[model samples]
Target: MHTRALVLFSGGQDSTTCLADALTRFERVETIGFDYGQRHHVELAQRGVVLREWRARFPAWAARLGDDHVLDVGVLGRVSETSLTRDMAFRMEAGGLPNTFVPGRNLLFLTLAAALAYRRGLTVLVTGVCETDYSGYPDCRDDTMKALQVALSLGMDQRLLIDTPLMWLDKAATWQLAHDLGQRADPAGGGDALVQLIVEHTHTCYAGDRTQRHAWGYGCGACPACDLRAAGWARWRGERGAG
Candidate 1:
């Protein structure tokens, strides 16, 4: 029954998929992106570009998608020394979380998104957090999101639903979901435009290297993000071919 939603978007593949999914399910959908001083700040920049492109590509769905709000939380970057917020090399040593794991990044993001939703009378908050192919971030877990949902509701005195459509889905399944949603939203004969939008426009690279382009999108192909995305794309192609 929750018709209004705010998606915690990062302009990445997962988030962009969530946004596309939201546009289909929600009566009104808005997006919130953060500038928490991440090293790949280009993701934030690409958010605006993605929104603009979506508006042009699907004019009928544009109004329902609503506006994208980018918040400035530069202090998060200043206080956190994770590789994602600095120029450090990526490392995921045994028995330890990766350096790319930004501490409390999702927690802070969801908290702020909930606050915004509460203020705006939105009852649902969508996030693209997935545990299946995630980077071992504790906050991205299902239990964490469930607990946060209850806490946010109790703390804000509002019934808030935290939607995680990608929770159980791997990257390939995520791509499939995007493809399905895109096709459903297509106004023309085919949904190739929507699929291309996701493939070419969305930014998923931790290194944020747009110069190094690939079939999936822009990224430093060496980074973990890019590797995961590439694997997913390959799996998706394999599935499509087999089908």
Candidate 2:
């Protein structure tokens, strides 16, 4: 029932899709991005570009978008030795978690987001966390988020709705959702506006390479993030063909 939402956006495919979905469902949407000294911090720049493009493409919806916020949690990088925040090589942990997993990253993000939302009088928090086609990050799990939501509510003493539109969706299904959102936002009343915005403006590469452009987007194709995105794109294409 909340009309306003704050999204934890990363300027990646999943988060970007979540943002578009938020625009359609909420009267007001704001985004918060973090600068935790991650190697792929270039996505922060892409976040600005994506917001600007969305504003230009759909003025009505864009008007509803609140200012994008970037928090400097770089201290996390100093304290955490994860591949995402440090120069260490990426690998899997003994229990099967990726080395890129920054302990309590999502927890801190959601707590910060909830604080912001409370101050802004927003009642909903949307995130792009997906269990279907994502690294084995325990924080991305629905149960974890739900537990955090309850904890946040108890701590803040206010009701906050946490929405995860892509929780049950695979990467290909996510791509399709983005496409569907684009069609809904198209000024012509039917086109790929959302998908186009995602491909041209968003950044998902963990390597933070802006020079290497592909059919999917800019990325160092060899990185795990890029590989996952490419695989999703391929599956999406195949599904389209089959349909």
Candidate 3:
């Protein structure tokens, strides 16, 4: 029997790259997305389209896979105090923790994902939490992931592997991996594809602003997320130009 994986997908650049990465490693791949009442509902809608496109583009893989699941794990919605789920007015920070942090959001999502994986009899779960690019978030670190994996195993009495392919990699490296996987083509597109995808298709703005475009994407550009994305894109584009 070949390895099977369940991906925690959000249709963002990192998660989509992880999806492509899962394709190379698993015999079958299925995705699970959670709607935790994000400030930006447009992203949730875009996730549906992206998943549909992926299924259409990879029918053979889809045939071997189990049904992709999307659930409303909106328990956090009621209790979420972060700007990501609340109406709290916040300003984008430079290098500090932003209001976009949904308290215990990843923990809840992965807990649900683990339960779903156990129910599906899958021992492996893939996530795209890049610590290098966004370590300011408490949940995106390796320690939190490992602790969750351990807790899930202890709680469920079954061993599970949480794979983080982009855990240590930076934005440029992630773009490179997506390119290597043929999910992206051209250096120009390669450098900015993730940014564009993140901007237009996925929503990272805490304000939920769908209007206007920034250097990084459709963001305030002052937010931590946009700043990191912009810096990475600029660096990658400069390198591409020089080469």
Candidate 4:
């Protein structure tokens, strides 16, 4: 039997790279996305489109892959004090992190994914939490993921392997990986395949504008997301030129 993995997908760059990695490693992979009243719900819809494209591209992939599940868990936004959850006028604090840090967001998402996996008899849970190439989101670190994995296993009496393929790779490397995975590269596009997907399909904008496009993705260019994206663009473009 092919190893089954449940991906905590957000359709963002990191998660999409992780999803592509899961597709390569796991013979059977299904995605679980959340509509947690985020500033960017359009990204969730894009995730659906991406999945549809995947299914169409690989017709048998859906049978091997589980159906995409979208749950409206808006309680996180109601309870969390972070700006990402609440309608707080947050100013981005430099050298620390972005205002959109939704505390316990990944924890809650992973916990829910683990619960679903446990119920479905699946043992592998994959996520796209990158410690590098991201803000100071504490939950995106490996330590938190490990703790959550242990907690899930002990709580459910089932071993869950939480895979983080992008945890170690930087943003440029992530794009390179996506390019290596046969994702279409836009020649006129300065960024790699992952970056292009992130810009075109995903939404990292905290203010929630889907129509906007930067060198990175759809976000206010002044936000932390845009900063990281700009830095990544420079790095990838430089590397591409040098190569």
Candidate 5:
């Protein structure tokens, strides 16, 4: 069993969920975030808030929580003109991908994450990349993750297992996963606490609009990130109500 893990956390709902999952699965779990000069840099700020909430509310996971590292990869934003990194309006490109799809963004993140994991003696690398309910970013696909896993292991000469707990799960299921994880950590009120932490503190905004409030979370409520999160939350809550 891989004892230690490093999650590629972005302080978004997805990554935040992955972090919670990691804290439960691994004996020790660390987090790594990237500052790619994206338009929604606010997520970086929100990362701390999520961590603090979890530490204060969930003692079980807090005991397992390790260090958090944020790397400044501003070069990615400098080179890419995508809507996520720039102030431009969002649109679909003729090549059949969203303008927010930053080429090689996930790849670079995993590469850097693997390097950090190697130095830190972490064997498992967890990411929130999901093709199920995400933009049509090729890098978010399962194949890309598998290939990167092999490549990272071969390149680093270490057994680095890439874990994608959200690969097959939709946004609602992702939310449910967090709920379940929280319950395991703190059975009394952990489920609601974790879900509340995500809805109130985490971010999934493409435009980084924290002013607007929504049931799902904080976002512009218009970007693809917010749309997925909102729709997922509605579906999950709707089903929850029906059940």
Candidate 6:
């Protein structure tokens, strides 16, 4: 079994939830983020806040949380002309994908993560990329991940495993997963505390607006990312109230 893991964390709702899950499962968990010159660079800043809060809040999981890495891959922005890398409207592109889709972003991230994991002797790599409740990004698909895992293992000559816990889960289920993870980590107030932490601390808005806060989280409330997050929060709440 892979006892150590390296998570591709972006300090967003999904990545934070994935990190929490990793902390619960792995004996050692580390995080990696990229400085790709994204529009929502504020999310990068929130990474430290999330880590600190986790240590203060969940002592059990804090033991498993290890080093963090921020790679300076600003060349992604220079090559990709997407809305995330440039000031462009969020719309479908000529390739029938959202403009927010940064080509080769996830590919490079996982590749780099594999290299780092190899050096750290970590056998597992966890990512928050999801097909459900996500913008239409081909790289986010399960098939792509599987292929990449195969190729990476062959190229690196190591039995590295790529785990995507959120691949089939939608946003609402993602919220529930975080709640369950928190409950397992700190039963006293784990679920509620984690949800609250995610809402207040994680950043998902494409516009990088932190001054404005909403019931779901902090965002501009109009971008596709915000829309998906808000809708998931509403659905999660509604299901809980119904139960």
Give the poorly placed runs of model 3, Cα more than 4 Å off.
56-66, 91-96, 183-200, 213-217
lDDT of 1 by residue, 1-243 (tens): 799999998888899889888889999998899988788888888888888898998876797987778889888898897888888899995658888887888889989999888888789999999899978999999999999999999999989999999999999898888888877887563266776887888888888789987887888999889999999988988999942
Instruction: Go through the candidates in order and give each one's C-alpha lDDT.
Output: 0.87, 0.88, 0.73, 0.74, 0.91, 0.93
Off by over 4 Å in 1: 187-190
What are the per-residue Cα lDDT tens digits for candidate 3 across 179-243?
56643333434324433454456555545565867654566666555666667767666766832
Higher-lDDT candidate among 1 and 5?
5
User: Sorted by lDDT, highest first, which candidate order results?
Assistant: 6, 5, 2, 1, 4, 3
TM-score of each: 0.96, 0.96, 0.83, 0.85, 0.98, 0.98
In candidate 2, residue 174 scores what lDDT?
89
At residue 43, give the lDDT of candidate 3.
65
Query: In candidate 3, how many clashes are counted?
Result: 0
Candidate 2 ranges beyond 4 A from true positions = 187-191
Clashes by residue pair, model 6: none
Pairs of residues clashing in candidate 4:
none
What lDDT tens digits, residue by residue, belong to model 6 across residues 1-243?
Answer: 789999999999999999998998899999999999999999999999999898999988888899999999999999998899998888987878989999899999999999999999999999999998899899999999999999999989999999999999999999999999999888898999999999999999999999899998899999999999999988998999942
Q: Which one wins by TM-score: 1 or 6?
A: 6
lDDT agreement of model 2 with the native: 0.88
Clashing pairs in 3: none
Q: Write the per-residue lDDT of candidate 2 for residues 56-96, one digit (tens) a residue.
A: 88877777888888898988888898888877666888988
Residue pairs with backbone atoms closer than 3 Å in model 1 (clashes): none
Instruction: Please name the candidate that would achieve the greatest lDDT relative to the true structure.
Output: 6
User: In model 3, which range of ten residues has the least summed lDDT?
Assistant: 182-191
